[model samples]
Target: MSAPIQLRPDETFILNVGPQHPATHGVLRVKMQMDGEYIVKSETVLGYVHRMHEKMGENRTYAQFLPNLSRLDYLGALGYTHGHVLAIERAAGIEVPERAEYIRAITVELNRVASHLFWFGAFVMDLGGFSPLMYAIQDREHILDMLEAVTGARLTYCYYRFGGLYNDVDDNFIEAAKRFIPRMRKSLKKYDALVTGNIIFRKRLEGIAPVSAEMCRKYGATGPVARGSGINFDVRKNEPYSVYPEFDFDIPVYHECDSLARYRVRMDEMEQSLRIIEQGLEKLPDGPFMAEKKPKTIKLPVGDYYQAVETARGSFGIRIVSDGDKNAYRLKLRSPTYSNMHLFDEACEGMLIMDALAFMGSLDLVIPEIDR
Candidate 1:
């Protein structure tokens, strides 16, 4: 008979992960308890980049706060803008015209594609492959050019209005988007060849960060994290906001529940977004872009309104508690990355430091979004 080994209860070591770690990709602090390189316990402390967005929204009128949403999630500014604007519209009972809605949907989907392209690059980069990042960004630049032409901005687009879009899509803008899609499709094959099939990347990412569907549900995980775990819930599909149902595209789902699965989901989703954009552009009607009487001064009735949109990372929800005043009484942004990051402790438990970075990359977290 072999004797059982006794271990001390106080045997634990702390490993600080960031407010500066490359894996974190932004300002974030994670205190991890380790048994050697494998994490045993972890706690993430955020707010390093907190700008008090909710509080800021309280003082700004609905239209005035549009630009601020772009600042919260800089990587996916359009998505943030969509969430904020849609929330206000829903609360104020503002109906955007069909043409404007189509434009909004197209732009939002373009932004979603751009965000995923950047993530595809960053995720591969985190896994120690730099080539894919550049390749992915190459495709992303085309969309940025198209967006800049219409929005007068590249990254932070203040182009969404209360009842509709800030401006209409011109002939040149439509032509440019039409020309770009086919080329973009061809380039995706190159991206796949560069990283997806690489033995090293596959080995590193496959079967890692196994987040179960039950775990995702318990933590309120949304977007790719939940979808990666075989959860079929998508705010775009489920809630059906902003002209999404008019387009035909399959919501990509993966049963692997690992980093690789999430990667595949995002890649496939980019294709689906392109399809939606094509359909939106085709079905787009001609009309006034913005509502003529959208009210320069906006006020909502005293009530609470919650709106959720499917962002590049996940579902972003804005909760507004209005007091029938120009300023919001209270505002809360439920960013998807914040919840998606919660599962790190469990997913990273037995992972090495390198594996931990890979897991973090797979979550596709935007630090400001998480910290905010």
Candidate 2:
């Protein structure tokens, strides 16, 4: 009555990549059934870093849970912070100061740049290039210094508040950011010359792991992974929030649908983030950083609320169901890497194990985000 989709492999062996290794990125495991070097099928082993982040949100006050957002996608912590803060502010009917919004945009973009720079070095290292990681880390430190000065965090930042920021940015922070931009521009050029143009790097990723636009849509992917496959969707531009509408930047989309295309999307995005940061600094307004009359205790009405933000990996969304309580009746977190990583099981099948690893690197996954 029905035919089998394909013949089963006569012989195959299961292999575990890691719960502790670089190939999976941050406590992730990949289970691959291999027929020689080719993968017969693959399954991603998640929950290695699960922290019950959503449940924590339901138990704590709206303000108390802000710090937990950073722990989800530590590399792009501010992006997750932005979403949660926006959700709480909207629910409680708070008005954020324009200056605070501008500052939020600037810091988040800087964080995005830092996240991409880390990905660039790490992804290349996965493919056997080590020199680039040192350069990338050195450049990334400059960003961390500036962010740490203002947000007081090297990583896992909890800088945003319900109505605004925890504190205002000083002139020194603005000056540091402005000076940092041109220097970063030079660094991006160097990265392109050293990594992007290298023949070996090109050969490794140029046509490896080609994920199509339709496949990206089917899998509900976003950020560079989807953009690499020719899908042009970004929450910042598609659905403008905060001060993003005032800034000018273009979404980087590549039709190549290969590992190289994903790599290029992130590289180009760092440049776009710099553009957003530069514009934000120029248009910096003089106003209070926090709402003068921020509610001392936020208690949302009985309803369901949702907010979305474009993180370094992809779109991170927060949903809350409240029954007129200080603590949410139910809280849900939608992390982009979760959706992006799910596609790996299907995409890696029938490909060489080495190539499958290359494809996984292309995803730019941060496993804690998925595990959450």
Highest TM-score: give the candidate number: 2
lDDT of 2 by residue, 1-372 (tens): 898666466867899889887788889988888888999888888898898988898899988998999988888899999999999888888999999999999999999999999999999999899999999999899989999998889998999988889899988998889898999999999999998999988888888888878888888998889999898999999988898999999999999999999999999999999999999999999989889887789999999999988999998889999999999999999989998998999888899988888888889899888988
TM of each candidate vs. truth? 0.95, 0.96
Displacement of residue 318 (Cα, Å) in model 1 is 0.8
Instruction: Please provide the root mean square deviation of candidate 2 (C-alpha atoms, Å).
Output: 4.8
Clashes of each: 0, 0
Candidate 2 regions off by >4 Å? 1-9
lDDT of 2 at 146: 90
Taking the tens digit of each residue's C-alpha lDDT, what string does model 1 give over 1-372?
998875476587898988898888898988988876778878888899988888888888877888888887877889989998899888888888889889988998899999999998888888778888887788889899999999999998999889888778899999989998898888888788778899999999899878999999888899989999999989999999988889999999999999899999998998999999899889998888888767678899999999999999899999999989998999899999989999887777777877788888889889888877
The Cα local distance difference test for each model comes to: 0.88, 0.91
RMSD of each: 3.8, 4.8
lDDT against true structure, model 2: 0.91
